[model samples]
Target chain A: MGFSISVEGGQGEATIKLVGELDAAAAPQFKEAIEKLAVDKPQRLILHMDQLEFMASAGLRVLIFARQKMGADVSLYVIGSRGPVLNTLKMSGFHHSVYLQDTYAPE
Target chain B: MDKLTLPAVLASLAELRRYAREAAAAAGIEEERSYQLQLAVDEIATNIISYGYKDAGPMAQIVIGGEITADVLIITLEDHAPAFDPRTRQMPDDDELSKPLEERTIGGLGIYLAMEGVDRFDYRREGERNLNIFEMRRRNG
Candidate 1:
């Protein structure tokens, strides 16, 4: 019903936690968060979408925007995306472009 | 058939999605297919509000309705916007989809996903209205 975004960045890694639905109305908020990350251009961008219930194309657009804005050198990871959110990404063929994981565990 | 009319604006999209979801449920659709139905409706509704009636304001409206057939569910979205059919949009082919993010353009992705998500999609112009029809076959357990 509602959307919220929280970001944390340090050590060349930035993590964003997304909750609720990511529809057209919430796309701007996600884009804004990505814009801020663009400034840092962190080596890794990990998106925590375990709590995300839905995602429309607008949300996918922002993900595309985030990848382009952050540059190709940055590794984008989508963590815990399931159900509709995962379906949207896969349907758009976006899942091929990102690292999808159930958890953000680095070895 | 059940229908809900909403102002053709971004804010009205949430309500329209809700209507689509409920209609899918009424037709005995499961969660995954229901979500696909919702996405299909949301994409075209967005195109209508964002492009069709760019400056039409609150006077412009979108009508969303659905009907349940014996083996299929049909959801329709009607708007008084331009005659542009979403089916005409250039969809991203496999080569384009396989390209890296930096090489890709965001245009037409929504339409591609919308059309792909539904079992059947049709566009029709009925006088002053543009109707987008989405159909999904009901699977029996």
Candidate 2:
């Protein structure tokens, strides 16, 4: 029903936790968070999407934006993406760019 | 079945999605299936609003109707904009998928997802009207 984003960062890695529906309305919030995180220059960026129920194309744009902003030096990981969310990523070809896992373990 | 009618524009997206959720549930789609139906509908509707209506100005009207049987859900969107068949648009091929970030082009990715989300997609023209039909198979309960 709503979208929420929380970012956790320490050492050389950063993880972003997303909860609720992510549509065009929430994409700006996502973009802001990623843009802010890009400045920190974390070597790894992980997105925890276990609690995310929905993701539209607008939200997908933010993921692409994050990849472009972070450059190749940053490895992006999406943890716990399934069902329609996973399908969207695969369809957009984003699955190839990031590591997708059923669970998140700090590496 | 239910119909949601509005002008084909970005502002109508929220309403479009809201109507889809209700329609999907009414059509007996389970939670997971409902989600894909909503996203699929939004993607196609967005296409109609963004590209289908490019020359129709801001007042182009889009009418979306839904019907569900015991086995499937059908969503049909009709607009007065220029006829466009998303099927003709090329999906991002494996070559593009393998490209580096800077070399990738995202031209039809959104529509590609829309097509992949649904079981069947069709586009046709009748006079000045363009019709896009989408179908989703419902899991046996």
Candidate 3:
């Protein structure tokens, strides 16, 4: 229904934990977070999505935006997405752009 | 189980979700099938609002309706916008989805997903309106 984002520092990476639904209304917030992260230019961007319940097409656009904003040199990790949320990412072909993991690991 | 209507836009996505759940349940679709139906409907309705009427100004109207008969779920979406047939759009190559952001073209991906998600797809241009009909059936039957 909504999204909450948190940024954490770990070794050489930045981990973002997202919870709740990511749709059109939530995309702006997600975009802002991505923009803020782009400034730091972390070597790795790990997204923890275990608590994220859903993702709309607009949400997918933000993921694509993050990929572009962060540049290819930065690794992107998506962790713990399940059910419809995971299927959506796969169907939209976003799974190919990032590393999908069952859990996040400290870098 | 019931019928509902709402404006056709991203904000109405929740309404579509509710309709999908009701229609799928009435059609005897299981959880997985219902989820697929929801995804397909979302793709189609989203396109009608975002692209079909993109330049038509703000007065454009879209109506979504659905009914379930036995094992089939039927959805009809009609919009008053420039004549456009979603079925005519070519499906984007899956290989192209990962292309660099600048090289990627906008649009068509949602239509592709909707087409693949449904068991049946049909489109008709009536007067100044576009009508899209979609049907979903359980994989086993």
Candidate 4:
């Protein structure tokens, strides 16, 4: 329906699972989550986006926000983003800002 | 072609997307292509609604309509805001995109992504209305 963000993992790693549509209306919740997560200073911030149904430019802006908030050293990963969500990332060239993978195995 | 009149606001985006989905499906557009169509429309609508006018008052109304023919898909957005042309924007140059995150600009990517998969995108001014036309060749073509 809307958007939900859940943070998992611990120590230097955290997985933020995003579900539902990520449009302009839903972006605030996402940004709030990112703001909260940034305080943890996780070395690896994994965005698990397999269930992310749609992503508009607003959502893309949040991805940029996360990069700037987390700084240059935090290695960010976008996992399993498909359909419009993936296409939006690729089309806007935001795909370059994160490591995209079919799956992420926590070590 | 089915039509929807959306208030220019972020709150209207979900319903705008719903209308886009129904229009695309009724036109026999498949899921993938429909997504592209929706993305293209969303980007434009967001721009017109978010920036075209500065008012919490009666927002500008954006009318969107679409038709898919045997060989092509055409989407039209009619807005009564100040005349602006989206096609005049060039795709973000390599240098802009290549800029480091902290150095990159905040805006401009939305309109750039709007034209990504479409075959031809045109903009025109008719009296007080700005008509944006988005066309794409069907995959089978």
Candidate 2 Cα misplacement greater than 4 A, ranges? A7-11, B7-11, B54-60, B69-72, B98-102, B138-141
Model 1, range A10-106, lDDT digits (tens) per residue?
Answer: 5499989999888887899999988887787798899999999988889988888988888888888999999878977876777678888998975
In candidate 4, which residue pairs get closer than 3 Å at backbone N, Cα or C atoms, i.e. clash?
none
Q: Global lDDT for candidate 1? A: 0.87
TM-score of chain A taken by itself, candidate 1: 0.94
How many residue pairs collide in each prediction? 0, 0, 0, 0
Q: Pick the candidate with the highest DockQ.
A: 1
For candidate 4, what is the DockQ-based docking class? medium
lDDT by candidate, in order shown: 0.87, 0.79, 0.74, 0.79
Q: On a 0 to 100 scale, what is the lDDT of residue B54 in model 4?
A: 58
B43 in model 3: Cα distance from truth in Å? 1.8
The estimated TM-scores of all candidates read: 0.95, 0.82, 0.85, 0.89
Ranking by TM-score: 1, 4, 3, 2
Which tens-of-lDDT digit does each residue in B23-128 have in candidate 2? 7777777777677778877888777776777777656788988888878878888898777888898878778876655457757777777787677888889999
- Candidate structures ordered by DockQ, highest first: 1, 4, 3, 2
lDDT of 4 by residue, B1-141 (tens): 768887777777777777767877776777887787777787888888877765536856888888878877788889888888987766577787876665667677878877775678899999999998888776635
Name the best candidate (by lDDT). Answer: 1
i-RMS values of the candidates, in order?
1.1, 2.4, 2.7, 1.7
The fnat scores of all predictions, in order, read 0.74, 0.34, 0.26, 0.53
